[model samples]
Target: MTACGLPRSGPTRGQIYSGSVEKGGSTHVVNVDDRVNRAANYSPAYGFGSDFQSAGQVGADEVRPGDVLGLSIWENVDDGLLTSMGASSTQLQQLQVDSQGYIFVPYAGKIMAAGNSPDELRRLITEKLSTQTPDPQVMVTRVAGDGATVSVLGKVHAQGVYPIERPTRKLSSMLSRAGGVSIEPEIAVITVKRGGNSGKVWLRDLYSNSRNDIALRPGDIILVEEDQRSFTALGALGGQTKVPLGNEQVNAIEAVAMVGGLQTSLADPKGVFVMREEPQSVARAVLGRNDIYGTQRMAYVLDLTKPDGMFLARDFVIRDSDTVYVTEAPMVQWTKTLNVILAPVNQIRTTEQGF
Candidate 1:
């Protein structure tokens, strides 16, 4: 009985297939081919979506509540309303915008500064003070504050609130102002949250895909995260462990090679298998059926012994949380059986020699 069957690294290809369609099991074991490869090819969607991408850039000159402003009023005559004894101009510095978005000018009364640009506010202030003072020249300068700022956190060199300025009016420029990402760009993921909406994209895509570099907005929250896409490699391989996908796309061939390739002396070239939970849509496409309504258990078989086996493996895409298993060669089980039977016989011979 021991010689008939022995312990192996994993189940044989035949055993796996036999149990696939069992009464209690719903696993679909399908041989991978060109058609299946095409149906199963997957690329994760990573973008900021249409609304975020189409948003215009933030107005850097626009003022908001909680900002500080500087105003200077100049009069043609030295003894004007805002001027000192001999000075033709007077300065009002550090005028903070109230919560209601109003700023008080000495002679100009309360003015709304939140929605207006500095130039517009300057013109408005000059017009208001013209009645009291003759041809008053006004200058409005905006100072950075918390009203129009964004918080950047996670995996960035600097985690803090950044103000929207001319140089940092867009998402990419703001990230740069924060000292860029500390993690690898290829695996870094950037997420932006504004109000009730949020979007995510790969860091590399910001430059490669122009649409991903969206404009920044006030009160936006930006986060940089490490990519979590990875798969588990087990059975007749050099090592059994969870491997991170370092690139945007990883195929079966690359995944196998990632874990130090298969154990040359023990791996069965015909029993390489990729196991995953397939979504209903992908399942229907792969099986050429429409009855599957939910996520299904799927086991894709790859026969490396065939002429096109390597090509099929190369074309087969590996998704996150997938399991890549390679069974041991058939001779390995026979070798284990022979060792079990020969152990007792060798022990008996040793006892006879001792007597």
Candidate 2:
């Protein structure tokens, strides 16, 4: 017997043989066939995946002003040898290298600091200081300064400029410092703009296993996107629900589960429907053989009758601003009606009898 106490039956033959009255159990066989047909046609169409790659790449060489300049200098001194060094300290005092990539020092005057390591800066400074003090000491330090400010905008707790001090800064670390992404995962798209350029960085790539490196530069803007679309889910399963599709996408079965899954007494379990708007732009793109953003304007119908359907649930990712709906069993309404009709009559009889 099945869990619901229905008899477990083996697979039957074809329609004519199984449903014919001469073969016996014609109504049962016919119903089974109808159910299969419904399940086959009920799968939803829309899903999710990588949509675009125009976002700018995060490379290591993007440096800005107010960035610390660490320096060390060594020179031949009359009293043995003297070495002096200074690490960039304050946002204001951080060495400001000019457009020509030269930093001005007290004694060295103007020396190139860009594209040079601490040891290199020390050597350069030593060369300049040596001209005055016979054997001058040298030091280099990239101090903490205003040059390393990174801007984080969009769906973060505190969207503004963040200072970069370490050798490497990660996307996740930056987001955490900026108060993290919003609670709504789907509506958020983190855009990292390099050098004030309009291009963005893909959040997925930063989170994924491949090439998870985002070297930040000064003036990079991270924009968090808000939820842009709205969708509704209703039907046989649990209660109807409405959800907004921000930057992320959702799928059919997942949508059903989100609204509390099928109400055992009211849900059919096998019937589900996803209704969505049909936009002309999407159709035009599809017809013109253009790559349309897959997450936009699509719906799906799913049947969760069989065990294997569970696997499909994962592959069918949903989009931001999509809807899911489940319909109730046909007999549920009749059962409710019968209960309502009997309630008044039972109440009247009890009142008259004072029971």
Candidate 3:
């Protein structure tokens, strides 16, 4: 009954090994060893390069178009050009900078406000109004507006547009202004998009490495997201599902333990396999060949019964999208067959004794 293909979980060791060379099969079955463990230890790099780290904090309060400014002008004479109704002072509130970076005043005509500081614009306005009024006093101040602001979104407590203030000019500070990330710091990723350039770094890296805390720019968009790395667990195991990587790095032993270690009653200790696609460089190093191109399919076998198997599994890394499978023991099927054949016999014997 067992030879007639009795029910079992996943393929057996023989099937997996033989399938590697069979027609239409591309998988290469290899045993987990120290050499294979070193070759397959591949991890994708994540960080903000020099392009993002080189920028220093810039002047956050620099005026720009779309900014709102308030101008207060005072003259010694009660009937001065800017004064009104015999008053010696005049207030112009809600003075918005036009698209061309210019703002108009009553006697000052049009003054370029975008590229100048508040003090610079104030001096320029005072000089212009002096021609019509005696020693005109002018004050310019920046108000809340859309200029020099950044948009923060994704996995944060607050998602909105924030102005680039003096204290919130750096990436980390801006994230704090948005109430920080809601996800786990270990798995959270911060992405900054400026113009046509974009960069990403782990939330922990932002503080661990000072260079990652780059300066924030106007019109920049920031997004915080959780890590998406995960592996699939299949066959004779406590839980067969896609398991999210809980840590930054995970090994084969840890991966199996996460899914509730192999089912001792029905699992074959020698048939454990970790299946994944290996890059050309890694495949060449593992197989000692130069014919490899693109990615190649690989099924690494782990025999817990061997003396060095446990160590090999401990050193072997489980990468994203990899599959960990454990086949059922050979005797499990025979036991099921016997149970199916003798169930009726046992029932009939019980009925005879009752009669």
Candidate 4:
């Protein structure tokens, strides 16, 4: 049996292989006829059989223009009366909603049609027609522009404007329409800004059991940020390196691991050092320029090699462009000097190869 609890079948002989039964019944050899019957009766619940319904309702009141309206007229004109009265039928061309949000009708001068439903516009036209003809019959329909468009930019697939047809369109709907996030599981970051206030929404949070509510308006902008995960593994490390940031938050331990762990082969792991760039304002007085220093200042730096440094690392959030550098041991300076001396030879060899 496979993981889904379906019996496995082989190509050579279409029969169920004999296996021990948990109920202690004697195993019977399955015949090809029984196999065909079982195969024919098999039904899967989670595959193509599952139908998808739209997440929200769409109504005509949600219609806007550049919208096309199809208008039809029905009148109680007697056939003989029409023949005697010389009644006529007229067909209009592609009627568009004008800039002022009004549609021009044959008899009705101008009717505001942009935000009104077809039934509502029909009633309005009926009222206008009542002035000239008693009990005039008319019909109005919305043929286009049921869909409203919004734009998504700053790091998303199909990062442009898209049209949404439903009024209950959510933020996730727009993201899906825009081809989801530009990056994958570990590097994706989505930021939703609404009413001048910003909030972060992770892809995992979106798909979690605890759903996050992100409503969308017509002009709302969603930004999917690129992976900014970076660490400068320096001093006392096995290999001084820079690690690329992935989607999830990277801590001091993970950052250190990227540089091949603490150089236990040379330096003391307990004496590791992390050098973070403190905000310029915190060291403003250190710059010895009083005229440039201001009170509205922000600064941050956390050392993670000390015993209590893990707590600081947990509390300290890395900023977008912040750099994290680890210090190497003093004994490593000899290796650095050797590399510095060989740098000229390496460059000369590279130049010779290019030539």
Q: What is the C-alpha lDDT of each candidate?
A: 0.89, 0.52, 0.87, 0.51
Instruction: Kindly list the per-residue Cα lDDT of model 1 for residues 149-185, writing each as its tens digit.
Output: 9999999999999999899988899999999999989
Across residues 1-355, which tens digit of lDDT does each residue of candidate 3 receive? Answer: 4446666777877778878934457898888788888888877767776877787665876788899999888898877886777787888999999889999997678889987889989989988888887888888888756778999999999999998889999999999999999998988988899888899888988899888899987889999999888999998887899999844789989999999998989888899899998888999998878988889999999999999999999888889999999988878777888887888999999999999
Better lDDT candidate (1, 3): 1
TM-score of candidate 3 against the unseen true structure = 0.80
Model 2, position 116, has a per-residue lDDT of 65
Q: What ranking of all candidate models by TM-score puts the best one first?
A: 1, 3, 4, 2
Residue pairs whose backbone atoms clash in candidate 3 = none
The lDDT-based order of candidates, best leading, equals 1, 3, 2, 4
Error of 4 at 319 (Å): 3.9
**TM-score of every model versus the real structure:** 0.82, 0.46, 0.80, 0.57
Clash pairs of candidate 1?
A: none
How well does candidate 4 score on lDDT at residue 329? 39
Q: Cα deviation in Å at residue 49, candidate 3? A: 2.6
Worst 10 residues of 4 by lDDT: 43-52
Better of 1 and 2 by lDDT: 1
lDDT of 2 at 16: 22
Question: Model 4: clashing residue pairs?
Answer: 186-247, 187-247, 229-245, 235-327, 235-328, 236-327, 236-328, 236-329
Better model by lDDT: candidate 2 vs candidate 3: 3
Candidate 3 residue runs with Cα over 4 Å from true position: 1-5, 21-23, 73-95, 98-112, 123-137, 183-187, 279-281, 334-355
- Evaluated against the true structure, the overall lDDT of model 1 is 0.89
**Candidate 4 lDDT over residue span 1-355, tens digit each:** 1222322111111111223122343322211122222322221111110111222333525546676777765444443211224453334445677766788876677889877887888898778866755566677766665235567887677898665556336667778888887777456666665456555655665555223435554445677776555655555555666677555455556666667766565554433333333333432332334444333222122334467656544433333333444333344445556666788999999999999
